[model samples]
Target: MATMPSIRRASSRTTRGSAVALALTATALSVTVFLGGRTRGPAVSLSIKSPATSTISNGARCQSRGFRARAPGVSVNLWSGFGPSLGRRGLSMTVAPKAQVVELVSRVVPAVVPEDDVAIKAFSSTPSEWKGDMIIIPVYATPKPEGAEEGPNAELTGPAKELDGVLGGIISEMIGDASFKGSKGEKVSTFVPGGSAKRVALVGAGEKDKENSDTVEALGASIAGVALDAKVASVLVVSTGSQPDSQALSSGVLGKLYADDRFRTGDNVSKPVKLKSMEIEGATSDALDAAVKHARGVTSGVRLAKDLVGAPPNYLTPSSMAGVAEKISKDLGLSLTILEQEECEKLGMGSYLGVAQGAIEPPKFIHLTYKPKGEVKSKIALIGKGLTFDSGGYNLKAGAGSMIELMKFDMGGSAAVLGAAQAIGKLKPDNVQVDFIVAACENMLSDRAMRPGDILTASNGKTIEVLNTDAEGRLTLADALIYAEKLNPDKIVDLATLTGACIISLGNEYAGMWSDNDDLAAELLESSKDGGEKLWRMPLVESYKEELKSKIADLKNVGGRAGGSITAALFLKEFVTKTPWAHIDMAGPVWDAKAGGSTGYGVRTLVEFVAKQQ
Candidate 1:
């Protein structure tokens, strides 16, 4: 929970028809009446007798006036005011119990803390100008030789040189002793005895030649990990070597500061130490401004994705998920269209409905659009698989294959696209129009659940044979991909946690990419690289389509055990024929086994790719 600034309370009770005169200021606005004339301890009535038509924007004065009322049972509504329509509105209200008034006001102000309360700032100032609880300096894994001079080593070239001089060569001595080689994920900390800063932390950046946005972001997150429970009010990150990508570095810090402690209970519960501010040093004024804009969009998308994926299945059902989408559209001013299950059936989404039939929850097909102010430069469609929970249907995941408890995360792709929509909607590019699509549903075990050997047709008239019910993600995506193609966008990209075979091929650190067009594949690769995401291009393998061919239907949902990921991609390719399309299989990197929580993969990639369309 975030600590609220001091609030001023004004209280007073007046008998019915008896008026109390009060002076109103800029911070405190007029009052609104609730449950009018309801009586309890003291029947306090309020009327706006003053002609204070001017509105106040300051929050402090509002708190001050809230507590200054004379009536004991009177309560001031913090977020109330009068406007032109109801001109000459005043602050006169009646209340019930005296004790209930104060308690209600207290509860209303700081009840639920939204996830984006923390602020991240990037500054053009030097290390010496930053004073905080802790300052982090990133150093290369290799250090200068014992007898090496100052100009020869790149690590000592920038603000780091001045920092070392201030600390009496402590950084150099620590690196010289071979104790802190600055290897990735390595850290060392010490107290700054003379400076304004209380502590200084050194983080590893690996080899200089191999440095990229990923390495820089990893180093930033590593620093945040140490500061998590240190009760540090503010953090400062200083660049020692070549300046890393400012946006990636700052985003990593912001993503870590976000905590999902909403449901935590018990006396020993750990509360995240709220950070007052985060500052990164050593950038020009213009550069700092650009970095701040990009980081704001990317971090917001990442946090939203993490929040959705972290939600339990029961709490985030298909209906509730549509509710969230509706709220986002309302808040961000995006055009939203939600199709009910009956409407989807009209479009002949047999493949999608087949997987959804087992669950009691109704399916929702979500379509959200973002348009620029000027003439559009390009059109792009982003589709995400929205299986809120996957029980492997009738195949029934058992033993080692069953990770049913963690099935809530199967909607990672949906979270990413929605997160990107939340970002692009706010960061509105001037040239591109984007459509975000998701077919949200669940695959649960029941009498109506989809079974093996089921034949289903997609919206595009292509049939799929469901050989293995566990391969249901692709079934849901088939109709979504077909729907996206009908929009006739220049390019389409779909993200999904489709197959474990990709994890086997590329480990948990990388996502597999399959594309039919070379240019589209290369562009997405470069965008992911700049966004600090790892995407490895895999072959479309023309021959792999042979494995998906079925005896009766157009294709099979699963292609045996060999090259399973490629075959799944091939199945989706059947639906998208014209528009250049790329498929991202992110089964592995979406969730991390590390102690704290999810890594929030693919959000940055989607945001970056869409932003570039500008």
Candidate 2:
């Protein structure tokens, strides 16, 4: 484990307003005073009132207005001037105030600070300071060039140091660290004392920079993570500028926050945390409200997925997975059907049943449908390989392969599909119907367990040669994909932790994607980028199909070592006739030994894609 640097506490002060203002001008200043459990100090209130212009002047009096501070000598200063179209710019006293915070902060701090320093600062801040908080940030924005609003690269800068410090502190605390490791140009947190706020966050906005929506989203997420955990009911984001739209900033931040790790579980086993409201300062009230709503919805979807993925295998087994769908249908007014082992047998799912035969628990084939509230325009089907566990079957794994103990994540595909359904159910888009199909079972070892070289028939009556029992994910998906095609879907997307070859091909950073349709691939790629899930498309070579051809069986369960991932996808492609389809191999992302936990990878990307299509 890495040790984070401690947040150095500055000394306390009770100077008249003027002395505190003068103190702020100095390079290193600290003001620490214990206010009545609720009230912050007078000088600190003045500083936050109008951080840009309100110099820490002498004898500043603190007056309270609902949790906000008002005082003499407090005035607002616009940095570069406000505008709708300012390109990227760094934060400097000389630059226009319109710059984005990310650019400005990036220039001042080392490149590494975005991830490391932010994490450190966030973790170092005390949780008490973060409790029930509202941190205000003042920023400047620049005007855009005439008639160039739609031109490429019209993005702007964000808030300044005050904002970064607050965000960093919140993030560090959430991840149980004082510092953060994040993407580039992101500001970390800094500390401020004395205000109604338990903690005041100050972020810097670079001069003359345009805004990047993604950066704002990240900001919102960081804030929410801290606020919710701190048991804070609300957060007030104060922006300084005539044209500063609080709604836009809030929307961006909240949206991103809601999306990231929305589908996660805390080890503490505590009750769920909820955020009540977010108030925006210095920006339009409409934008603030819109931001709040968007954040709520996005986070709601993410949390649903996280809850499903985080559940242990015992609680989320095949029958339990079916039960989950049944409950969702009853609660959300959706349609659901659960097929038992007898039904699957009637459908001739021999290849799928072969894997289930090993386990004492019966397998379940779940079909969950979401009907449109209005006219249906597009119908899509999602198939997930719900292998509860993989024990390597007859060709039992040994030594390093024994690490397959975490194979419970083999059902990660099912988690993603179920998670997507939950999100769509809440959003309730019109004219788009979606069906979720999961072939849920366990691949265990027993007297009746499947053996290598065994031949099994699929639901489509196609015989499969099971050369390796370890390759059971594809076997289950084969029947599920065929079942999805029966619905005549406009598009079919299947997710599975099917192959280790995928881990080798794309590493842990990216999921391996195989698709025959270019349009589907493009749409999925765009969704992945928006959702912050990395995916790399791999070719489905025509030659790879040869590896699955068997002398007796219609296809072989395991392909050759070379292009093993691609061949596995090729095997699945044979099940779908004309429906545009894509396969996501999530072997690398399902579980993380290095991180000592599960990643919950495909849920976000799948949900985003489905929501966008609707």
Candidate whose TM-score is highest: 1
**lDDT (CA) per prediction:** 0.73, 0.61
What lDDT score goes with residue 207 in model 2? 35
lDDT of 2 by residue, 76-181 (tens): 2111211223232111111111122222222221122111111101112332343446553433323434786422221212332334454454423422242222
Which 10 consecutive residues of model 2 have the lowest summed lDDT? 113-122
Q: For every model shown, what is its TM-score relative to the native structure?
A: 0.75, 0.65
lDDT of 2 at 28: 19
Name the weakest run of 10 consecutive residues (lDDT summed) in model 1: 34-43
For 244-319, candidate 1 gives per-residue lDDT tens digits of 8777776666666676665567854557566666777766667766776777777777777877777777666666
- Cα-lDDT of candidate 2: 0.61
Leading candidate by lDDT: 1
